[model samples]
Target: MDELRRALQTRIEAGTLPGAVAAVASSDGRARVDALGVTEFGGEVPMRRGTPFRITSMTKPMVAAVAMMLVEDGTLTLDAPVESWLPELAGRRVLRRLDAALADTVPAQRPILVEDLLTFRLGHGLLLGPESDYPVAAAGRALDLTLAEPFPRTPYAPDEWLRRFASLPLMYQPGARWAYSTGTLLLGVLLSRASGVPLDDLLRDRLFTPLGMTSTGFTLTPSTAAQLPAHYQAGERQDLSPPSLWTQRPPFPDGSAGLASTVDDVLAFGRFLLSAGADLLTPSSVQAMTTNHLTGPQIESAGILLDGSGWGYGMSVTVRPDDISGPGRYGWDGGYGTSWCNDPATGRVCVLLTQVSDIFWNGTMPEFLHLALRCNVPA
Candidate 1:
């Protein structure tokens, strides 16, 4: 564990990373937390355990957890269609081809299911097609239908954003393929409409509160806001610059990317996931969530995102043992630099938070995962 701490410190001293906060915990609640580097590149504030990280797409798991809670409570069902809640998605269309024109579409065979949203297979995504005429791609970008893929988040209020999203045709039939980001955002709306409450409030009552994760939320309270560091976007030369205004709350709390939390907050949730949802979620639901639900071309569609793992509801469930961890080790990374892993096999939980984007693919994440894995679980 000391080696892990020193290695992270070495990165900070080398100026490769601005700041990081990491923690490793076991079943009994004992934890080892290490903080390294300044809050901003050359700023005076030191990184602390309480530092609120932007935690981007990592928001999916907690938001997914909220949806599952409703599922368990009988307010929502996994395989059931979400059309009842948000009428915008009731009668959907699918493109005949990936590059097909919007008008050249077919009627959806079935409504998008709750399971489809949970599994990220509900047919819409940030396709980023270079052909600017692609209506779905054009509409997504013009309406700001995403958050923090490349940063400077989507600016639309949730209702208008949903309206714009509803106007776009599905990239594929419901449950046909796995797409990035959009299904999760839509799931946020699904949870809100089905629960008849805001997503944040549902998350607060069902997840954040029970987990004792005080610093985790879509909106930053002043106290937690103060702990937030200047977020940086990594340049080609490794120069870290503050990307955009992240200090204030956004108009819509994007379930896929809009979240701010601490290492402890992440770890607490990680531990719950390891504990198969602890008291908040059913073990069966957790089991289903951590199980690999994507198959066939879906894996191919995911490209390298799965990285030889499987997609559980909100996080990546390890399907096969890798160098750092084994099958059943589940969790995901944030678009802004933060990642967590829960190894049910070894009873280990690791939470690592930083301020760079796409930290999962970079050597930095795997390097830290190795170190954290090396730590003997706290007695």
Candidate 2:
């Protein structure tokens, strides 16, 4: 195990990555954690066990769990139309693609439901793929959504931003297919409205406080912010410049990828899911959140495989475990180079955290997972 750790460390030292933290825990009472390289290339801080990281979309599973908790408590229904909670989504329209132009084709056959958000069928796209005209792209551009610049710090204060997002045409019919979108952010909006609390406070009161995730939250304080590792682009050794001052606005409480947390904090979250709710969630709710809810290759592509891997409320299920040659593992990755997976069949959970962008599911992540699995075996 130490040899594998050394190999990972050596890789980072040899420039395969900037720095990383990896941990593995199993139901059989075996665990291993290792930190490699420097937290910042030019800083003196060594990557440590409790280093905070911008977890990005890795926040999805936790947020999904919270939404499911609301469902279990009868505060919300998965099948309920989201527009019922926020009338802004009512009478929404879908876009019919036209060459060099967009046409507002028709009203949706049905209202967008809470389940759609969980399934990524809410018509917003992540804007990186070929299908760039998805609602999130249009909405982000229309509202000038940029996270690099600091904006109003209060939640839901960016009403004009959300209004623009609500007005954009959907990329596809609700529940017709799946696309990784801002559905999680929409879920955050719904959660705040339903719970009558700001998104950050709800996360703290509901999940973080109970799970002992003290280092986790949406907005970073100056002290915590200073501990944050600089984010780097893949293959680039230099830190990426901060976004323009004008683009620094906090657009909305994005449930998908807005939170920052530590590897240990997330390990507790993974264990909670694996144990089927230790304190913050119910067993049934956890099961429902991890169960596959989408069918067919509704949103399959080279980059995002939506069919072979099952998607639950906000998780990616291991449907054909053989397809990926992994056990009955279920979890998701963040766009900003963080990933966690729990293999129920093997009773093991592995987490990797870094500040490098676009490294999820790429060579860096796969290599780390390979080492973790190798280290999990008994001598």
Candidate 3:
């Protein structure tokens, strides 16, 4: 374990990453944690256990948990049409792909439900693919959305972004397939509307306070902001531009990809879901949240291949028993190189945190996680 930590530290020192923090824990009372490198390249501050990093889409699972809490409270239903709560989504339409242009085509076969967002079955895209001729390309052009670059300086406000989103045509019919869209952001909005509270406050009251995750939130304090590592691209320091669709403030606590957290704080969250301590959810709710809800292969191409490995409500389930050799191994990753997985079968969980994008799909982080899982299993 020490040797692996040293190797990881070497990679940080060699500029392979700005810095990183990792943790491994098991129900048998074995654990290891390490913080390596600097929060920013060429900066003197050493990464610590509490150093905050932008967790990006890692925010999804937390949002999903909160939504499920609402589900348990009877404030929301997984199968209820979202338009009942937010009328803006009423009269939704799909887009038509012509030879060279996009057109508003037809009303969806059905209205989008709250469950659709949890399973990512709503007619939306990640705004990066050309597979479906949804007006994503056009919307991206109109909205100036680009993945290769940082968010635009003068971005759209949250309400404005929602208005624009409501105006755009969906890529497919609701609940037809899994598409990785900004559904979580919509979920956040729905949460606020349903709970009659701000998104951040609701999350803090519902999940963070109970779980003791004090360091996790949508915005960082000025004190904590200094400790946040700068985002990077291709091993170089990158500018931290304002988001294109929302500011890091109230009225826009984006539940989709806006939040910062530290290793320890998130680990507490992992422990809660893994049921290492008092469980926040009933076993049936947990099972429902982690089970694959998508009916077919439509979700597989969108990266919700949870059943094959499996997918629960907001987390990804390990469909292949060999993937982690567990009965209930499930978790998710963020775009900013942060990932976590829990194996209920072995009573083990591993987390890797970084600020680089595209880490889970193609980076050493996933490989390191697999190695740690293999090594930490009790023989």
Candidate 4:
């Protein structure tokens, strides 16, 4: 455990990151949890074990778990069209080409399915490379859809957000290609509408409460806001300071990237999935959610983000082992410099939390992940 702490401390001292909290648990009962460095560079607040991080896209897996629960409760079905609950998306248009104008479109080959949302096959999402700045992505930005930015969140309520989203044409036809970001956002609203509960309340009643994840939610009250570290990009502080963006619930509870959580809370989520939902979700549902749903071509289309991995429901599935992990390990990263993964082969769950977004693109995140695995896993 000290090895893990030391590794993070080394990075902190090296100016790679401000601070981090990490936790690991294995099925045979071996476990380690530790925190190192300060909340931010040169700050007096020591990073505590329970400090909350803006888990960002890590919110997807939790939301995906709740969606599976809804599937089990008969509130939703995977194969069914989502138009029943999301009538705003009943009629949809798709761009003819990745660079096509917003009005250069065709009717959707089919309605977006519940499975599409979970699997990220719902067409419109973040584009990469040359197509990234295409008209559709521009339209999404103009509408304040908050498609991919982790900070500076959407201001519209769910209904208005959905209305704006539905007004645009999908980049690809539903179920045609695996895109990123948007589907999970759609699932957030779909989950709320289908259950007739607000997204925040639904997540609380169904997932967080059941898992005893006390430190996970859409917003942190003022009293607990101190637990949130100063978020950063590069070395400068971001605007997401304490008692601000995360203190009060945003008009939109972004299912894709809008939750603050502690490392243990995320670790518990990994454990829940590793336990095959442990009574909250059926084994089959867990299987479906963790299994790769992308075709090879679709994976290729996903480009750098997939990075030769596969996407299951809301998380990335490791189809091929790499330096940091083995095949069948399933987890997701939060754009805000947090990583969570569960390796069923070793029955190990690992979580690393930090507030610097640059670490993901920089080498720090991968180094931390590799070190965490090496420190804990027996030879």
lDDT of 4 by residue, 1-379 (tens): 6666777778888987878888888766567877888887788888888888888999998899999999998999999999989999998988888788889999999999999999999887888654355988778888988997856778899999999998999888899899898988999999999999999999999999988999999888776776688888877788744556667778999999988888778878888898888989999999988999999899887889989899999999988889887888888998878889888887888898988989878787787777766666442
> Candidates ranked by lDDT, best first?
4, 1, 2, 3
- Please give the lDDT score at residue 239 for candidate 1: 27
Between candidates 1 and 3, name the one with more favorable lDDT.
Answer: 1
Give the Å error, residue 329, model 1: 1.3
TM-score of each: 0.93, 0.88, 0.87, 0.96
- Range of the 10 consecutive residues with the lowest summed lDDT in candidate 4: 370-379
| Model 3, backbone clash pairs (residues 3+ apart or across chains), number | 8
List clashing residue pairs in candidate 3. 289-313, 290-312, 306-310, 306-311, 307-310, 309-318, 309-319, 310-317
Off by over 4 Å in 3: 28-30, 98-102, 130-134, 144-159, 241-250, 276-279, 303-308, 321-328, 376-379
Error of 1 at 250 (Å): 3.2
Q: Evaluate all candidate structures by whole-model CA lDDT and list the values in order.
A: 0.79, 0.72, 0.71, 0.86
Best by TM-score: 4
Candidate 4: pairs in clash: none
Residues 233-314, candidate 1: write the lDDT tens digits.
5533222223234446667778898888898889888888777778888899888888889896687677777767778898
At residue 43, give the lDDT of candidate 3. Answer: 80
Instruction: Kindly provide the TM-score of model 2 when superposed on the true structure, using C-alpha atoms.
Output: 0.88
